[model samples]
Target: MTMTSAMPDGRAERASTKSFYLIAWRWHFYAGLYVAPFLLVLALTGLMMLWTSVLSGRDGEKYYTVTPAQTQVAVSAQADAALAAIPNGKVVQYIAPRTEEGAAIFRVNNGDASSMVAVDPYNGTVLGSWDRRNGLYDLANKIHGTLMIGDLGDRLIEVAAGFGIVLIVTGLYLWWPREGKGFGSVLVPQFAARGRQLWKSLHVTVGFYISLILMIFLVSGLSWAGIWGDKFTQAWSTFPAAKWDNVPLSDATHASMNHGGVKEVPWTLEQTSMPMSGSDAGKMGIAEGQPVNLDGIVAFARSIGFNNRFQLGFPADDSGVWTLSRDTMSNDSANPLSDRTVHIDQYTGKVLADVGFSDYGVPGKAMAVGIAFHEGDMGVWNIVLVTVFCLSIIFMSVSGMVMWWKRRPAGASRLMAPAVPGDMKLWKTGAIIMLAVSLLFPLTGAVLLTVIALDYLIVRRVKPLKRALS
Candidate 1:
């Protein structure tokens, strides 16, 4: 079986395949260079946050108590006690305890400062207070979300997350074994392999295993991003206010309920307009003999089945309604399916609107569950699974850098990127795919276009860069 007679197009097919692999390798390398550091940071911070949340809890023991009295003081008395603790402070919200032995948490504001005041439910005594955003768990969350650099950090992280997808895709293609290679080559690393081969084996094997989970994490995390998550996805998928019949809408939104620089409402409800309190348009009214106050609102909330660690956002202004929300997003309830939000007219004592998981659209429902899983709030199994996923991400990022370092020429001054293939036709298809991805992820698209332009205009034109890169 001579080669010329065996297959007329054998050489062309092999060349095409080789070119595809090289293109994939080049993009994979570029994406890894940018995404690896961000992934490492995300993995480390996420791991710390997960353990902190699981072990010590977000509020910590200072927010709870060990004993429960037979008789508890009124909610109003608790609010007064919390007010006395901080001079010139106003009560913003009241969080019900998870159990009888737990203390109620109150959000108190004093001028520019916000603090969480834990009050003993039994006798209305202020147990302790701490700045809401300065807690260790909150610090980890801020770093994880914004790198503590605010909006700029948010955009940069979003770009990294977007390109991370590109890395995963190209990595998989390059990792795919050629014909005659067994499953062990794909599934298991050869410990005997040395240098770059060892790194490649470990990198590909671990990357392949965590690819799906990593993708899920990226998508769910992206849904919280400013542009994609908030403007595009969340705006379209949020719970609509049209469901509320004849309720007067306020200029303020559910975002106003997010006091102390922390999000208290569910993602889908953040943009939903909060209904005003002036109108008596609600269907449900307060119980007989109950006054239109915190006690009545609490009773109303319990009557509607909002139990166990539900949060209550007090009226901020005349138009504001008392908001009672319970969701797995806040770790208030264990089950995502039980997520609910109720708004009550502060004066008229009417239930303005109530939204539950069933009321959510497909996207909203999915996000609810996804966020719970993302935060490792489901159970012990979820914590273990998320921990493994985080560790795998860390390992993959470190291994990728090792591979790149090993592949670079000795004493190289520039990035040793993969060479461009000779045939340009295959790259046209790749360019179109990259364009589509960029369009979907705005920041990623802009970065990719800039890199491509630099490669053509700057990198290839500069003598030192071209030589080093080659």
Candidate 2:
């Protein structure tokens, strides 16, 4: 009698486990179907960006080779060379060469168009000039950010990233070792396995290995998304302008410092209001005889410890401050912890406000470090690790589709999604979990709810739709 009762209990437990597994598998399938393409694109573009940064540099071959001189020409002279390259051009920003051998990059505006002119610091010769946003690497970055479709594409990518979390979670649950399974089977792909089994092994193994990396990439990337990053997180993470004591705040925010809609300010100060120039409300940064120009600002920046690839933003108006910034966001500094931004009065050459990494709020600090790692700016190891992670993502995406294709019945026209388990208890629990996920990722949640409503209200009620989905 005891044995018989134990048998039924064991059966019941196994049945429950099987039901939960099936539900998780179904959701995984659904998520992969939609998210795989986006993941592949992101991985490819990300790989391109990584290599471009490593080889030609993010600004392209401009940073590659320049003969260093014992003494270099003045930054103002370099600016003149850059401006002379374009008719009626106004210099907006000057990016000091990362090294003595690197070319100085000047952002020039001519009417409605913007261009970046590279000049040799040694001779103030125009090395090259191109549209600021048209570089191959920049194109890759744009595709990675917005898919070249603006807001709608950004939203779609955001949703995909959010759902990618779901994929990782469900994938882990599905790949969890069953009783008696060995480490080799779980960790390594079995070459002996054929067809779907081979694909499944490869997929599960690679997915498990790269899960954490994928999560990090997803979260970091999402931090730049429109709704979640900009509206919510960025708003709270921004440095408070109240920190500037006795300085007159400008009507413009630090976002005005950005060039061609590209973020140039430190992540923490992007939303913070900039201090205006006009009042004698800052410490004198320039010498008595020096004028407030590119050369003076560069000298002031170096004196204030803004060294190694710091960017200088020329004053936009008479009241605007000359902005000097060094942050990992622009790859200006390798160390994210050393991020600093200073605004100098263009008229008085007085330092208006100076903010550093230590001054950032908790969220700001996290993003500062996170963005550095995300961009593989930590070191060569970071580049290698991220490159492997990107390749793995591509492999996993392709393998998943292969597995699905292999499993499909011959001549079947419908998607062979896993059947919904008959147990309402598990289904209800899943619904609750999904609800929580939706709340956390609003755009993802909206998409999930729409799919659920369609599945129940439309697909279930319509025979053709039901058949097609099943």
Backbone clashes in each candidate structure, one number apiece?
0, 0
Query: TM-score of each candidate?
Result: 0.94, 0.95
Could you tell me which 10 consecutive residues in candidate 2 have the lowest summed lDDT? 1-10
lDDT of each: 0.84, 0.85
Writing each residue's lDDT as its tens digit, candidate 1 over 1-470 gives 64433555977678778878888888888788889999999999989888887766676633457578789888889989999999999998888888888888888899899888899989888888988767778888888888989988889999998998888788778888896797689799989999999988988898989998888888899887888888878888888888878799987778777654356688888898889888768976686557989888887788879887888888888888888899887888779999999888888788899899999899988988988888888888889999999999999999988888888879988787888888655887777765676668887888888888998999889998887776
> 249, model 1: CA deviation in Å?
0.3
TM-score of 2: 0.95
Q: Which model scores highest in TM-score? A: 2
Candidate 2 per-residue lDDT, tens place, 1-470, comes to 43334567888677678778888888899999999999999999988888878777665534446898888899899999999999999999888888877888998999989888899989988988888767677888888989989999899999998899889888988999987797788799988999899999999899989998888888888888998888867987888888887799988998777664356677778788989998888876787679988888898788879876888888888788888888887878789988998888888888888889999999888888888888888888888888888999999999999988988999998999998776545777776765676558789988998999989889999998898888
- How far is 108's C-alpha from truth in model 2 (Å)? 1.4
Task: Measure candidate 2: CA RMSD.
Answer: 2.5
In model 1, state the lDDT of residue 236: 88
lDDT of 1 at 364: 85
Alpha carbon lDDT at 99, candidate 1: 82
Give the C-alpha lDDT of model 2: 0.85
